[model samples]
Target chain A: MTQLSIDQIQAGDELPTLSVDVTPTTVVLGALASRDWRPMHHDKDFAVNRNGTRDIFLNTPNQAAWFERYVTDWTGATGRLGKMQFRMRDSVFPGDTMVIRGKVTNVSTDDSGCAWADLDLAMTVNDKITTSCKARVAVPSGSGDNPWKRRGSDWQPNGPGNSNAKANGS
Target chain B: MIEIPNEVGDWIGQPRYEEDTEFDVERGYIHTTCSSVENGNPLFWDDKVANELTDGPIAPPTMLSVWFRPHHWAPGRKKQAQPLQIHFDLKEKLGLPEAIMTDNTMTFGEPVRPGDRLKTRQILRSVSEPKTTKLGQGRFWEIEVEYTNQRGEMVGIESYTGFGYRRGA
Candidate 1:
């Protein structure tokens, strides 16, 4: 997979849309993989009768995996996640088509020299947003620069002007 | 609006529980997780591709919490500890029947690879006053969970916020 360098990205860049036809198996497997044994995510009767949802729905970590996959698929293997925050506005039940779309909000290098991209992303079902996400990812500043290799003080996820602090109001 | 008792509010800033995962991060588990999402990222499946990035194939960063999820049944254990105990505690303390997560933020530190064992610490961060929403009358609360590898290296932090309410209240 070809990795995108910082130079190749700019604010306002839109990522290719990703769409998935969610099914009962999709929901159950996601919950199973995450080790989430919550009945609402797997047991349809428990979900509809007890939880009062239309059907078994995707759990939080399941949705999180989806968002991470959507971003990394675009950034390629070299891309490393620094921070990801998302708000769930509604449930994504089986039979719904979840479409993910993203836009680059900003791209900048921190004082530590870690190049970063801030993205605004959303997962929509049938044109209605189920979750909205903001992500901070590290991309190569130039050829051969690997963000994953950075550690200790070099990687500051909550550094100044970083979206994490702003999102948490800290 | 339902009143959040002072005792419930006091949970804020208190570290709830710290527990180690039941098993080590396994390559097969990673494969199943990737398959569940239909994620084709080579880093998760291809050892060569992963070795280029880290020591070996790494678990997806989003799977940070999956490691600590309490098993449904253990041979000797009569009752399992509920996952996210603080959330359930709040629900019971406040007497809310329904709960839903509103938002979540995760920050990654180290790459979680096969054989790495993880531990997590949950802390209550904040709680909001009861308010009315379309769903019902509820309050919002935030909890932060810190994940660390067996080597004591930081893995990630998950800041989760949820709402607990009485249906149609």
Candidate 2:
């Protein structure tokens, strides 16, 4: 895997664009993986009749996970995810081709010497932005060990910790 | 005509998850999820590439909420009640038959690995006043789900927001 150091990354850098040919199978796969059995995500009848939606739509968590994969795919395994906030504007139905595009908007370093990049991403289909993604991701500092290992090496099961996107450190 | 229940405040800060502790995050499932999104990234499926970060491959950071789901065969699975849903009567009182997702924010805690047992709890964070929008008279509901591994390490947090609108215009 190619590791991108902080110095090598700069603001205004355009990340690769990904195009997805969404289908009923992809919609179901995402819902099944997330364990979301909401009829709106599976049962077409329930979605149209009961929920008043056109068809089975992608759940919010499933879309968030897709954005998460997009960022990490560029940052590699060493990339530590700090925070992500995205808004779903419209529903994404099966048989829609979603084109995802993103760009590095800003870069900064925390007091701990970890480099963080802020990105703006969007999912577009039929010339409409269905979801808008804004995120801050931790990346390699170009020197020393990866920040996550240096900070959170100990994995405790009983310890009370939060992984919410609101907090700076997980 | 919809308002948050008077007693709903009491349920905040409570553990929101049901009884199951084991996570179903396996490589096969992860691959399917990644593929479904059209992401053929190596880290999500390539053990050799991911092994460099940890002893084994890890699930996607955004996939945190995926692990806290209830099983299919469980009773009342069709209407699986989440923590806040079980404790607070917000939706029922709203009389809203339709739910629309508006926003989401997630924080990554520890790296979720294969075979990791996750313990989750949902806490009611806050609810907004009934406001008028194009959809109808609705209030925004937000809740936080804190997840920890079996070893007690914080895995991650996911907060979901939605608008429950009246059944008909």
Candidate 3:
């Protein structure tokens, strides 16, 4: 388990990096997970012919996940995502290994002592930035207690509540 | 050449409204990829956790991207796309020589769970005349979409900036 305090977090703190090979299978499967039946997202030939795309590209949902991973992984289990924003600069296609990165750009505390941070984020493929954004994450305050932690009463360890639940099988 | 009137151009930029639109969130492979990329655990798919955690089936925070899964883009439109993307379909169908996605921004809020019927409203933000570029002059417009969930709670907002260029302009 990772431990972090808002008082320890400051602007310019580097968030962890997530490197993944963006494959067509993953992209296509993602569409299924969301029940998004848009053929262009899965069928490369159909997309190239019908949608004028060069090849299968990452959808908005995929980009959003990338942003979430960037924030939560560092903030720990209790860290809840508050707000996230991303701009698609280029297409992410099959066989592309993207390096998603972020850094703490600013940190502040609300009147209620909620530790809020601004993160500068980017996803790079082939050394090119394909997606970039600024995200805000709500962290536990300096008091060393996260009010949201107790709410995980329903969270089942090693169960579906964990985003890494599938990795166990793989 | 078909020269669209300046008034029509203005109209394209003019803000319009979209309301009472309902969409759903479901579980599928997209969740898997999202999980892998984000290092999420199985609980995201654990129906038990979802039902117990949020008092309903919860979708990933990114569910907004797929909220339109059960709905059509527009009632009578042939091509399908995000509501914001479809806003420019009229220009595309008219054989407009050039349109490029100029800018886009999305601000996310609450996580949209399954069983949450979302309503999205849109407003025309701004439209600008053809601005000179190295390639040629291009027209631009901006539109905003405000989304509210079934609880009449604000979920998120999206702003789309689109630009179209005349062929060889």
Candidate 4:
């Protein structure tokens, strides 16, 4: 896997678009893997009749996993996620094509010397956004710097220069 | 018109439930999750590659809650564990027939690895006033879950918001 160095990232960088044909299996497997046994996520009859939805839909944790995969795929194996948050406006159902896209909002090294990148991502199905995300990830400063190796005071997820700080400030 | 019971307010800002995962973080579960998402990040698959960063192959940060989810059935256990008790409580208390999650935020801490047991504490943060929306009439509520490893180190936190409402009041 090609690791993304912090220097190569910019405030306006666009990640490669990811589109997938969401099927029933896609929704069910994701729910199962996340250990979400909620009937709304796997039982179509329950979702449609009981939950008042069209069909079974992706669970919250499942959507979170997709967001993590999308961000990590771009940052590569070494990238470490500090924080991820999203708002779900609608449900993702089977047979809809889900598209995920992201843009870098900022890049900077923190007081502890940890390189970080802030991202804005969205998940859309059939041209309508189902979820939107904001994420903070730590990327390597260079070939020799691994953000994953940072520990103790070195890895301050809520400190200055991180997304949590921005969220708090807002 | 919907009315949130006075007792609902008492649930806010309180630790609702504290429970441990049914099983430890396992490698097979991680692999299954990766396959489901089609995530090929080597850190979740290759131990050597992950050891370069942390102690060993690490579970994906998104899988924080998966470890805390209770099993569907266990021998000698008469009642099933409800990991999300607050959600159900609000539904019953408010007389809402249906519910949907509106948003979620997760802050990650220590990397979760294989063989690690995790515990979670659920806390109700806030509940909104009754409001009308395209979906229906309901109130929005937020809950937070803090996850810790066997060593008592913080692993992550999930702040989740959901709407409980009547289908067509």
Instruction: Tell me the TM-score of each prediction against the true structure.
Output: 0.95, 0.86, 0.73, 0.94
**lDDT, residue A155, model 1:** 74
Clashes of each: 0, 18, 21, 0
lDDT, candidate 2, A1-170, per-residue tens: 56777887899998888778888887888898777877789889998988777899888778887887777778876776766888988888988988878899988765456677889999889879999988877777886657456335222111224332323222
lDDT, model 1, position A83: 90
Which 10-residue window of candidate 4 chain A scores lowest in summed lDDT?
Answer: A161-170
- Chain B TM-score, model 3, reads 0.65
User: CA shift at B28, candidate 3, in angstroms?
Assistant: 4.8
Q: Against the true two-chain complex, what DockQ does each candidate achieve?
A: 0.56, 0.51, 0.17, 0.56
Q: Model 1 chain B — which ten-residue stretch has the worst lDDT?
A: B1-10
Alpha-carbon runs more than 4 Å astray in model 4: A159-170, B1-3
Per-residue lDDT of candidate 3, residues A1-170 (tens digit): 35467877989889878888888876776666555566677899976765456787776666777677666678754465555666767778888998888889888765445566778998899889998887766666755565233222221112223222111111
lDDT per residue as tens, model 4, A27-123:
9999999888889988999998888889999888888889999998999988999888899988999999999999999998887788999999999
- How far out, in Å, is residue B49 in model 1? 1.4
Show the lowest summed lDDT stretch of 10 residues, model 4 chain B.
B1-10
Worst 10 residues of 2 chain B by lDDT: B80-89
**Candidate 1: how large is its RMSD?**
2.8
Residue B160 accuracy (lDDT) in model 1 = 92
Give the clashing pairs for model 1: none
